[model samples]
Target: MRVAYYCQHVLGMGHFFRSLEIAKALADHEVDLISGGPEVRAELPPHVSLFRLPGLMMNDDFSELYPLEPGRSLEEVKNERARLLSERFLLFSPDLFLVELFPFGRNQFSFELLPLLQDIRDGHFGPVKVVCSLRDILVEKSNQEKYEARVVKRLNEFFNLLAVHADPALLRLDETFGSLDRVRIPVRYTGFVTTKPRSGAGIALRRELGLEPSQKLIVASIGGGKVGGRLLFAALQAFARLGLSGARMHVFSGPYMEASEFLALEKLASAIPGVILEHFTDRFLDYLDAADLSLSQAGYNTAMNILATGVPALVWPFDQNHEQRLRAEKLKQLGVLGILEDADLESERLAVRMAQAMEAGRRSGPAPVDLDGAANTARLLQDLAS
Candidate 1:
């Protein structure tokens, strides 16, 4: 089977990474991943190929769309994207169309997506199984009733299935979207999609870092780094205050952090000993596995990584929406991680929390939530195709 996966990440890289994991899991099928957000560095599997659309992203506030290429008007980019998407649909003629966070989210791209969905509905791409790949929680909209109605209408009209990438035991689509019963389609929970780190990778990494058994290794990161400067800066300050002997901290500022913010973080980190800062790394999971403690935002991908590695984590949920906070609260109840509050950002308080989290050590035993979402998603798509 050939799968054409459409993913548009306007603000963060979480959606892209999660979609990539699912594509990787579909090794038995050929995958054409359509992406239009800011370019990200990743290693694609042999069976998966990326189809880049003219870059389009949201403003910091996510109020409007802008072209990534300078001097190109938003209208020009949208027109080109629409044309390319239709052309690709005809060329690939994929058996499955896996759309990430559409109807549920990424409604900004409706000018392109709605047309493509319409074309597929008209049998322009032959018989294709249309699936909506959604995350666990949704950001509350300005008019939720209208939003739910629109989603139900779109899903029923164009989509064949709704594959929510969450463990229903932890979160269900209806919990966030109230009109689930109104949608006339199959909605399957494919667990939480994440790539598990290689076996013993963390242990090997710890040894390679030449760390003593007594020394603590803390890993800190901000997903995409566009809005995580506060958390990273605060974490660095807290680390400095900890003053723990033989402790090492690795901070990934994320690839998208503004240069000014990253430079500021670099300057601050340079003053502290045993602190290493980098823009990004492909071996994020390995580092998480090797870490004694993890500090970061509570996005779906990061939360899944913490769960996959069983690392003791302290997450500062994104304040703009209830998505991260709600997920973090669930993990907290499961004793899988701790949440960070605004007052906790104070260096002194954060330092204390850091110490306590490290002292508590890595989470032990099995993960409370299902972590086989990537493979399960592949299986579901394949079964549907069959």
Candidate 2:
């Protein structure tokens, strides 16, 4: 079966990577992956092909839309993207057309997505199975009820399935999108989509990085580096206060952090004996596996990685959107992670949590949450195709 997977990641790399994981899981079949965002380096499996469209990114607060290209008009770019998307939908003629986030999120790309859906509804792409590949939690809108009503209208008209990459035991759709019953389509829980580490990858990486046995390893990161400066900044202060504690810190400030902030972190790390700072690494999960503890933002991909590794973690959820807050709360309730409040991001408060996390040591044993989402998503796609 041929599948066309569309994903647009505006702020972070989470959506792109999650979509990639599902595409990899369906590696037994032909997959055409469509990405409509700024370029990112990602490893793709043999069965997948990529079709990158003209990119768009939102401002920091998601208040405005802009073209990724310098000095280009947003309308021109949007038109081009819409044209390309329509062309691809017709050419690929996929048995299944999977969209990462729509109606629920990525409403910015409605110019293209709505048209694509119309084509499917009009049978331009005959008998194609349309699905929404959504993350576990959704961001609550300002006017949620009206927003959901519009979403329900779209889903009932165009979508055949809703593939939620979450375990119902942990969180259900209704918890976030309260109008769940109005979706009017089949919803399938595909476990918690996460990539499992390779056997002995942690041990191998430790040896490669020359980490000593007696030294405690701490991995700190901010996904995509768009808005994690506060958390990353606080961590630096916390680590500095706990100096010479035999703990080696590795910090990934994220790829999109401002130059000023990243430079500050670099200078700070240079003065610190055991702290190493870098911009980004694709081997993020491996680093988490090698760490005694993880300090990071509570994004979907990072949280799932923390859970899969069963590493003791301290997370500061992005309070602006209830998405991260809800996810962090649920995971904290499950005992996999500890929360660091927005009120207490200062060095003194974080140092206390840091010390406590270090003293607790590695969290050994199997993870309590399901990690079979990638595989299960593939199984469902096959079922839908049949």
Candidate 3:
């Protein structure tokens, strides 16, 4: 089977990573992973090929779109991107079209997406099984009724199925999108998509770091780093205040964090002993497995990583929407993790929380929700193609 997976990440890298995991799982199929956001570095499996469109990204607040390259007008980039995307679809002639967060999110790219979808429906790209890949929770729109209606119309008109990458036991699509009954298509819950750490990777990493059994390893990160400066700064300050002897804290500020903010974090981290700072790491899951405590935001990918590793985590949910907070609260109820409040950002308070979380240790037994979303997504797509 041939699959063309379309993913557009405007602000954060969570969407792209999740989509990539699913594509990796589809090793039996020929996959063209189409990405049109800021370039992200990743290692692809032999069966997967990446097709890049002209870069377009959103501002922090998602108020407007801009081209990644300088001196290129937004209109020019959009036109070129649309043309390239259409040409790619016609050339690839994929049996299935896996679109990430279209009607449920990333509506800004409708200038290209709507036209492409319409073309597919008109037989321009041959017989294509159009599917939507969505996350668990959705950000509340200002006009939710209109938003949902538009989504239902589009899904019914163009999409063949809606594959939500979330464990229904943890969260269902209808919980966030209220009008699920109106949509006339199959909607399957494929669990939560995430990459699993290698067997014994944590134990090996801990030994490589030359850490004593008594010493604690704390891992801190902000997904994509575009808006997590405060979380990283707070974590560093709290780690300094904790002053635990021999304990090490490794902080990844994410690749997209502003240079000034990263430089500030670098200076602050330099003043503290046993603290290491890096921009990003491919071994994040392995580090989480080795850590006694994890500190970060409650984004989709990070939450899934924590679940996969069972690391004791303290997460600061993104305040702009209820998506992160909703997921965080659910995990909190399951005793899998703890949530961070505004007041917790204070150095003393956060230090206390960190100590408590580390003392509590890793989660016991298996995770409460399903963690096989990537595999299940591949199976579903293959079955559909068959």
Candidate 4:
């Protein structure tokens, strides 16, 4: 079974990371991972080949963007590199082609995927099951319900299936899809996808994070390498706001961050006692396991890991983006978390909310969110392969 996964991120590693995780589960099958976003550090298992595209990613405030090279002309780039990469990517001839998020977001790069999806749909390519992978929420700017309806409906028609990685009961903030519950295509609530508890490495990670016998640590991480800079800043602010002098703040600024940016954050961490701001680490889930509370932006990856850890968190979904705000509200309503919006972000408020979130997090435990997602997703692809 050969599966071709297409994920492009301009700023962060959420989509690519999720696809890589899913790809690992299908290690027995041949895999081709393709990207157009700026380069990121991705470790793929055997049988997984990677394809890089034309542009190099630049980290702007919102997310990653691929600007044309310093000397290369845009026209030349389009005439040469883009054309070649697109042709090369098609050579894979995958049995199952998965489109991550573009059906709903990222219309600009539609050219990279449109030809492929069209070919598969038209039988130009061999029989392929095309699926659209959706994170729990489609972050939007405002209540652009009218514009969103068009996109969601088009996405529904464009693919054979919709795989939502979030448990809606935990956060049914999918205004776009929630209304289409009666649609014919299967809306598989595949649950949250997360890195499993690796036996050998997890213990060391916990120890390194300074989890005492029962310190009740709270780990706050933004998603991979982009878009969560403000969230990390907010976390630092939250620590100071909440006056968490005793609690350990393990802030993971993804490794892809600029040296100057990271050093600046490091300075902030130094001034604040009990704050350990560092670069990316492998023990994401383990830190969650050892944590008493978690703080982060509402990216699907971080949310899934938090759920997997079965600990509590104070999640402040991104404010500028409407998608995360809705997601944060949904998860909060499900009793899986507590939230502070970007509008409500401040040091004092964050400190108070962090305390409340910690208290709220401990009340009962992780409410039922999807945990069997990775296996279920793997099964879906395996069946498609067959």
Each candidate structure's TM-score, on Cα atoms with residue i matched to residue i, is 0.99, 0.97, 0.99, 0.82
Query: What Cα-based lDDT does every candidate model obtain?
Result: 0.92, 0.88, 0.93, 0.70
Best by lDDT: 3
Which TM-score value belongs to model 2? 0.97
Q: Per-residue lDDT of 35-142 in model 3, one digit per residue for the tens?
A: 999888789999999999999999998889999999999999999999999999999999999999998888889999999999999998888999999999999999
Clash number by candidate, in order: 0, 0, 0, 10
Residue 299 Cα positional deviation in candidate 1, in Å, after optimal superposition: 0.3
Off by over 4 Å in 2: none
Query: What is the model-wide C-alpha lDDT for candidate 1?
Result: 0.92
RMSD of each: 0.8, 1.2, 0.7, 3.7
Best first by lDDT, ranked = 3, 1, 2, 4
lDDT tens digits, residues 234-286, model 1?
99999999888999999999988999988989999999999999999999999
lDDT of 4 at 47: 86
Alpha carbon deviation, residue 68, candidate 1 (Å): 0.7
Question: Candidate 3 vs candidate 4: which has greater lDDT?
Answer: 3
Report clash pairs, candidate 2: none
